[model samples]
Target chain A: MLKDEELDLLTGLLSEKYGYDFNNYARASLKRRVGRLMAIDRFPSFAELLHKVNHDAAYLPRMVQSLTVNVTEMFRDPSVFKTIRESVLPVLGTHPLIRIWHAGCSTGEEVYSMAILLEEANLLHRSLLYATDLNPMVIENIKKGIFPMSQMKVYSENYILSGGKKDFSRYYTAKYDWAKFDENLKSRMIVATHNLVSDRSFNEFQVIFCRNVLIYFDKTLQDHVLNLFDDSLEKLGFLVLGSKENLRFSSISKKYVQSDEKEKIWRKMK
Target chain B: MAKNEMNGFKVVAIGGSAGSLETILAIVQGLPKSPGAAIIIIVHRKNDLESILANLLSFKTHLVVKEVEDKDPIYPDHIYIAPPDYHLLIEDEHSFSLDSSEKVQFSRPSIDVAFESVAEVFAGRAIGILLSGANSDGAKGLLKIRESGGYTIVQNPATADMGYMPQQAINLGAAQHVLDADALVATLNGLF
Candidate 1:
């Protein structure tokens, strides 16, 4: 069992020296991530791990990447995109230029999914998509726009269920086990690294998709990230989340009204 | 009950699935009106239903028991329950957030997600308790809490309503205490 002193020491070092501030994240998750780090680094104790993380600049970023939740897929929870097609796209169609931000985008699947949706809606030409994640490796994969061919059949099904009009196979070409998405889809997206915990928002967006990412963070981090999303969005902008997620419980929940309750889509309240 | 010598709250994060209610009630009823830290419960279930587990638990314990909301402040002497279909996570500011992402371990409000998030935020200050679950989801997470210097408690498989979860936790070599549900409560009380 970790003594209270050890917890304090770890949180203190993370904040004072590294500026990560995990002091309030769910305790069990934090302990496990730290433990994994300890075993990987071959440290004998939590104290030694803390000392090393505080002193080593590289360690903190790596730790942050490891701690953050990175699981995601294209056209996940298909109904969410269906709602976007039915409700939000009409409003977005009116804009001459649209900026969409996929915050905490993991593995780039969702980014491509959004691109394909915009293309089918005939809005791709007028849209600029920015996909950002804390992990560089995931961002690199986003740049490649390639996914496992084995997963493509399921993804195609999800796209169709999400109300896609095009032949899903037209979007990618299979190269052995990998499916490289059409370059046309990739061209509209710019992938980068932006930390929701510590980094500042860089641009205004008409739509922000930060799905399932906040669940990994504790309430305070969720609030902070939501606030950032609110600030980054244009007036009456759209906010979509993973299907199981909702804005009902957050401090900022009142600021956004449900656009589609079942789909987990919300729009900024005027 | 003597107060825990530690200044900060000593969190006990509990994760369970099948046959957890009875075991949880037994442990909760046995605890004092106030323990030194907050108790957070993550129970896996389908997305559509309302959770009465909090109310059920409130009926059995004197501690303040309620469902956790996003940014609900972490406080001592209370039991917070994770709502259905959302993974509950701890914040740097000691609050909670629910994530509706893809379910880990094929269940929303997964024990692993909750355990991993708490382990990340609290490190050693956290105590992980794995009770009656059917899967191995809590095993890796309990191991993580142990590695972070947090105390780990697992119900003795013989005493648990279901033996799999507690047994798996023990197999992982993460549990510090593997007593029966009744004995586990007394042991926890002794710690404070």
Candidate 2:
């Protein structure tokens, strides 16, 4: 077993070598990911894995892919969407032009879900959804607007539960294993790779949906990203988070008041 | 690594995937009310639906069961259940953190992730239990708990609906006790 100092050296060198900062990630999870590679891939030791990451350019991308996740679904936690549809959407609809950001939008399922919600609410024509993630692979997938056909059943259920009035199946056309969503939804969305840790916030938006993305960070990094969101959000704009996530003790907690407490929805206080 | 004024046995993390809930209910029900230690539950779940696990478990247990939120304070006699999708982890001896990193063993709310964090915070004073499941998720985590000088247990494989999880932990030499449901309940009652 490696000592804590050795682990520190490895994580520090990873940032120096690859520009990915694992220093502020939760230590136990970082160890587990690295340890999994060791056991499954015959890395033998941290030194060997570090060497592979530094020497093999191809290996670095695969390592990053393994380290980052894209576990997402359409209308996930449908109640949160219901909160958006009933409360946030109406407020944003009053804006001359509504701008929304879906930070860490993996494979764009939820982005399309948002677009569908906007379309149904008659706000899609006036809204622009900016969906960004750190992973370029997922960004590319976002551009394609396709998902596994098998998941559409569950997604359809999620849609109906999220207060969808239209048939959920109408959003996508399925063939074999894949479902291609209606192209009209894509017109309102801009997909890009935006690393939350390294990049500055680009556009101030009316709502930011960075759900389930920040829980991986240590307290300091979590605060850092929260501040970034604070800078990017318009006053009285909405911010939604993952079910288990909260802004309770963060540096900017006082700046945002819990709007729909049960839904993890918050509104920036003026 | 946090200060352990309570003699190091202040945390218990139970890890399972499939076919383990019934046994979990029994253990939670059997444990004493207001036990000095904090009890944390980690199960593999993917539903975005409102969690009813804590609600269901609370009906059986004397303890108050609540779904975990990031930075939730650890409390004596309270049962904290991991919400779906996010991985539950300890921030320190005092609080917990949640993450959306890649799932391990093909599941989020990973047993290995939560168990490793518990081993770190509680060290030798902790207890880890691996129960019935079809998958091999908690095997390495149980090993980690034992290696960190904590006590460890697994449900007796012969009596398990899905014995593979307990069997894996036992095969890896992770368990100090391999007891049936009743015996398992008795052990927990005796421990904390």
Candidate 3:
């Protein structure tokens, strides 16, 4: 495992050379991930890891991917998606152009899930989904709209639990071991690389989904990201977080009221 | 009571599955109103909607009990139950962070994940208790807590509803005490 100082030094190096500011990331998970990376990549010591990262520019993306937690699934926490489908979508339907932003949309599973919900709600034609992430590789996957077939079973289960009435398999075509999502779902999506740590909010949104992304950040960075969400969210717009994440602890908490007390969906009251 | 031997400890991580729920209730019922350490319960669960377990446990104890949320601060005299479908990790000494990572031993909120994290964060100030269950999840983590100079206890296999879990801990030499439910209660109270 990387020592505290070594992790700090590496984060500083990444920031100085690559402008990736991971200094404000929560220390424990970051350390654990980096340590796992070193083990997987066969770095005997922290020095070797440091040397590889500092000298090999090609290794930067791998380092970043390993450090960020990207374990997301389609329709994850079905109740949250169910709440979105039942409560959030109807309200979003009122807008002539429903604009939704998926911040830190790793592998685009949740974005595709949202697209399916919009399609079912008969609002897909008018809605635009902006899917953004720090990793460009995942952005490419978003465009591909292909996920592992093994995951479809769980995703299908989640889809059903989220009040989805359609046969979940109809959303995608099975090609050997991969499930390729419908092309039409991708048509309304504008995918890009946007860093929550360094980038500004690009547009105001009726709804923003930044689930499980803030847990990796420290308190200061979490507040910063929440502030960014607040700026991007239109009044009466909704903001959703991970099952265990909270907007209540942040400076923006006062402006948002939880749309469902059991779910993490919150509406911008102010 | 154990005369406050558990006072300095920050976390008490309890891991179980299968027939462990009854044992958990008994342990919670036996504990004092304020045990002076945060108790974290990680049990294998299939349903995501079972906040019922939290409510059930809350009814048995005087301590404040709730399902743990991401980035929740750990506090003494409170009990935290791991939410379903997510792994609960000790993020640091003072707080917890939840993850939707791949399951360990076919279980999210795996005892191993929580125990290993508690071992790393709390070290000598941690306490690990493995109870009735059929899995091998908590054995390695109990060993980790012991190796880190923290205390560990396993339910006496003979007394357990399902002995496999505690038996595994015994096989690995992870437990400092092996006691029945009554003895376990007495032992824990002695710590306080």
The DockQ of each candidate is: 0.20, 0.50, 0.52
Q: Between prediction 1 and prediction 3, which has the larger DockQ?
A: 3
User: What are the per-residue Cα lDDT tens digits for candidate 2 across A117-192?
Assistant: 9999999999999999877777888888889998988998999999998888888898889999889999999888
DockQ of 2: 0.50
True contacts kept of each: 0.28, 0.53, 0.42
Tens digits of per-residue lDDT, candidate 3, A72-160, equal 89998888899888888888888999999999998999999999999999999999999999998778999999999999999999999
Off by over 4 Å in 2: A1-3, A37-42, B1-9, B16-26, B29-34, B44-51, B56-64, B101-107, B133-136, B157-168
- Candidate 3 at A165: error in angstroms? 1.8
Ranking by TM-score: 3, 2, 1
Alpha-carbon deviation at B10 in model 3, angstroms = 3.8
Cα lDDT tens digits, model 1, B1-192, are: 102324577888988889887878887888776687888888876543554787788789888987875556788888988887567777543577665555778887788878877776677678898988788778888888888778899988886778998889899898898988778788877765
Top candidate when judged by TM-score against the true structure: 3
lDDT of 2 at A270: 68
What is the C-alpha lDDT profile of model 2 across B1-192, one tens digit per residue?
546635543788898777888988888888887788889999876565446888788788777888988778888888999888778888777778887766778877789888878887787878999998888898888898898888998999999888999999999999999999899989888987
Would you estimate the TM-scores of all the predictions?
0.67, 0.88, 0.95
Instruction: Record all residue pairs in model 3 with backbone atoms less than 3 Å apart, i.e. clashing.
Output: B1-B190, B2-B189, B2-B190, B2-B191, B4-B192
Better of 1 and 3 by TM-score: 3
lDDT of every predicted structure (CA atoms): 0.79, 0.84, 0.89
